[model samples]
Target: MAKVKLKKLTKKFKEVLAVGNISLDIEDGEFLTLVGPSGCGKSTTLRLIAGLENPTQGDIYIDGQKVNDLPPQKRNVSMVFQSYALFPHMSVESNLAFGLKIKKKSAREKQEKIRWAIDLLGLSGFEKRLPKELSGGERQRVALGRALVLEPKVLLLDEPLSNLDAKLRLRMRTELKRLHKKIKTTIIYVTHDQAEAMTLSDRLAVMRDGKILQVGTPEEIYQKPKDVFCAGFIGSPPMNFISGEKVPQVKDKNIMVGIRPEHLSVSLTKIAQAIPGKTSVTETLGSDNYLYVDISDQLISVRLKPDERIPEDKSVWLFPHQGKLHLFDKTTGKRI
Candidate 1:
């Protein structure tokens, strides 16, 4: 495993700044994830660390050694791309052995490495199968195996599970976590999915535009978001925002109050100190119902129990749970 560090990293295209001055440290044997929307520079940051893209400014260090000028092959890092990037014509065994072959490992050493990777990735019987013969999940394992055989100090995964279906993606997430525990390899995973980041990472670095918004554990980022952007971006249904005027308790005139969907309760009967609204829609998931209510002219969502149902166009009252409100300055969008 390796400790990777980025110091004031910045990357720029001709007239566009892809990555702003950002510094981050990934501990050895830690599973860290970078998450954000498209064009947010999360992938660009990963590419810079992988030596796939050169930084216009700043420095990169791997295990305390400056590697900003080193080629990717010499960086002791392995990257699994979003597409898996497996060789279509090569068998699983051949693909796993390719990197070792380039390094000129002895026959016995090569065989041992291949065996380890195959067994570790649970590709025992599929060694002879070509990429086309394997399922998406299996092919992904092979792609991972190829990287594992190289024994890289740091492993970088760029949304490797994005191509799989929902069930397969969930299965792969568990498998990836298991693999990490077994090998104890340092991993830097990049994804646009907040759910993936929440589940897979020991720590998450949330990015937007060309800068990092915040870095913390999933729980920290969720429960105590530093800004409105983070609070809005990290949740499933997302936190509901109401202007200060709509919520009179908020004293700051230039502030917005945010209440999570799960933090608001709905009542069919009129209730004192409750916000009145008309139910616009209700979506039933397996375990819960999401109610979209139109209050004044703004729409706010509330999470309710599966049994709770309010007919569309029916009047309802919304009561925010005390102490669960999040306040942000409207001008800066910073937490207040």
Candidate 2:
């Protein structure tokens, strides 16, 4: 295991700043994920750590040693790309042995490492299979095995499961968590998928426009977002934003009230501090229903039980759960 640290790391593509000056510390054996929308620099940050991209400024340290000038091979870090990058003509065993062969390891050492990785990744039975013959998940496992056989101090993954189907992605997520537990290698993963970040990471850093907006555990970032963008971006179905003027109890005129769909309930009868609106649409997803209501000039979504049905175009009252209310400064977009 190794601790990875970045100090004021920055990357530029001529006139474009792909990664702004940012510093982060990844503890030994921890799984840290960099998550954001496309063009947000999460992938660039991971590349910098892997020595695939040179930093425009600042320094990178792996296990307390400065590696700014080290090449990727000398950095002792392994990376798994989105494409898997397996050789089509090579068998799984050969692909996993390629790196060790390049390093000219003893034949016994190479065999031992290959066997360990294949067994760990559940690829033992498919060692003789070519990449073309493997399923998507199996190919992904081969890619992972290829990286694991290298036995690097740090493992960097760049959206390694993005191409898989929904069910396969879910299964891979579980496998990855299990793999991390078994190996305990320090990891830095980059993905735009918030669900994957939340589920797999020990902690996650949310970035935008080449800068990190927030870094925290999934629950911290979810329940107590620091700003408007985070509050709106972290949750599923997104958070509902209402102008301060629309909420009479908001004392500050320059503030906006944010409430999650799950925190708002629709009521058939009148309730205190409830806003009246007409149901615009109702979406049923088996376990729960989402009710979109038009209030004033804005539309807001409220979560309801599957059995609770609000007819479209029918009037209803929406009430925010007092404990779950989030208030943000409208101008700065910062939470109050």
Candidate 3:
């Protein structure tokens, strides 16, 4: 395993700056994920680290060695793309042995390495099957096995689970976590799915428009977001933002108040010092129901239990939990 570092890394394609000046340090054997919306430069950053794309400026260091001019093969890293990219013509064993063959390892060495990969990925029974014969999850495991056979010091995964179905994606995520725990290889993962980023990463970097907005543990970022954009981007239903002037007891009228759906409770009866709103909609998702309350021109979402019932008149009051209100400056859109 090896530690990776980026110093003022930047990449530009003519007028488009796909990745701006960004610096980060990834510890050896750590699973770090870069997450954000589409076209947010997370993929560009991953490619730069994998030696697939040349940076416009700054330097990359792997295992304390500068490798700005090194090719992908010399970086001792393996990348698994979103597409499985398996060889339809070759069997699973052959696909796993392809890279070793190019490296010109002995026949016995190749066989041993292939066996190790197959066992590690739980693919012993499917070694002779072609890509067409395997399910999506099996094919994904084959792709991962192909990379693992090389024993790379670092692994780069770019939305590897995006192509699978929802249930399959969840299963693959669990397998990935287990694999990381067993091998402890340094992994740099890129994905736009917040659920994947939160569940898989030891630490996550939130990016936007070619720049990193915030980097922290999932809990830290969700609980105390530094900026309005990050606060709204990291949550499931996202945070509810209200103009400070419209809410009672707000000391700063020129600010915005942010409260997560779980932080606000709906009261059926009118109460003093509570914000009044009309129940606009309710969404039922298994165990929890999300209630959307319209407060004048703004809409607020509140999390409710499945058993909770709304009033027939559609009248409700919003009560923000104490010490849960997030205050942001209106002009700067920054937490205050």
Candidate 4:
């Protein structure tokens, strides 16, 4: 296992600065995920760490040693790419042994490592199968095995489960979590799927337009986002926001009022639990429902639990929990 530290890391492509002045610390044996939307530079960041791309500036350190100048092999990090990147003609066992072979390990050592990885990834019966013969999830596991058999210090996974079916992806994610726990190696995974990131990571680094927006545990990122972008990005259905002018009694200064849908309430009768508003739309989701309400010129979402009497669309009172409301500075979008 290794601790990785990225300091003032910058990457540029022509005129575009893809990752700028980014600094992060990944603890030894920790599972860290980088998650963002497309073109948000997550994959690029992982590439830099793997020595697949040269940094324009700054440094990358692993186990207290600077590695920006080190080649991928010299840096001793293994990468599992999004595409799986397995050789179509090579058997799983052959692919798993390819890396060890390059390092010139003895025949006995290579075979032992390959056997261990194949069994560990539950691919024993599929050892002789070529990449094309395997399912997408199976191929992904093979890719992981290829990387793991090398037993490098840091493991980098770039949306490794993106190609699988939904159910397979979910199953693979649980397996990956278990694998990480068992190996206890430093892992850096990159993905655009927020749910995957939330479920797999010990901590997450949220990126936007080449900048680090916020870095925190899933709970911190969800419950106390640093900015409006992050608050909206981390949650399912996102967070509901409303613009409000200064009212010392309600809150201070101009703020972007945020209330998680679950934090707001809707009722047919006036309720003292939250502020009053009118329902504009009621969406039923089987288990629960959402009531979009207009409050002081703002739209707020209130979640309704099972079998609650659906309120009339004409007018329904909205109550936002005072303690649950988040205030962000209007101009900078940062939490205030």
Better of 1 and 4 by TM-score: 1
Task: Candidate 1: list runs displaced more than 4 Å.
Answer: none
CA displacement after TM-score superposition, residue 325 of candidate 1 (Å): 0.5
Q: List, in order, the clash count of every candidate structure.
A: 0, 0, 0, 2
The TM-score values for the models, in the order shown, are 0.97, 0.97, 0.97, 0.93
TM-score of structure candidate 4: 0.93
Q: Rate the local accuracy (lDDT) of all candidates.
A: 0.92, 0.91, 0.91, 0.87
Candidates, ranked, lDDT: 1, 3, 2, 4
Candidate 1 lands at a TM-score of 0.97
The lowest-lDDT stretch of 10 consecutive residues in candidate 2 is 244-253
Query: How well does candidate 4 score on lDDT at residue 169?
Result: 96
* Candidate 3 residue-wise lDDT, 69-160, digit = tens: 99999999999998769989999999999988878788999999999999999998998999999999999999999989888999999999
Better of 3 and 4 by TM-score: 3
How large an RMSD does model 4 have?
2.2
Task: Record all residue pairs in model 1 with backbone atoms less than 3 Å apart, i.e. clashing.
Answer: none
Could you tell me which residue pairs clash in candidate 4?
274-319, 275-319
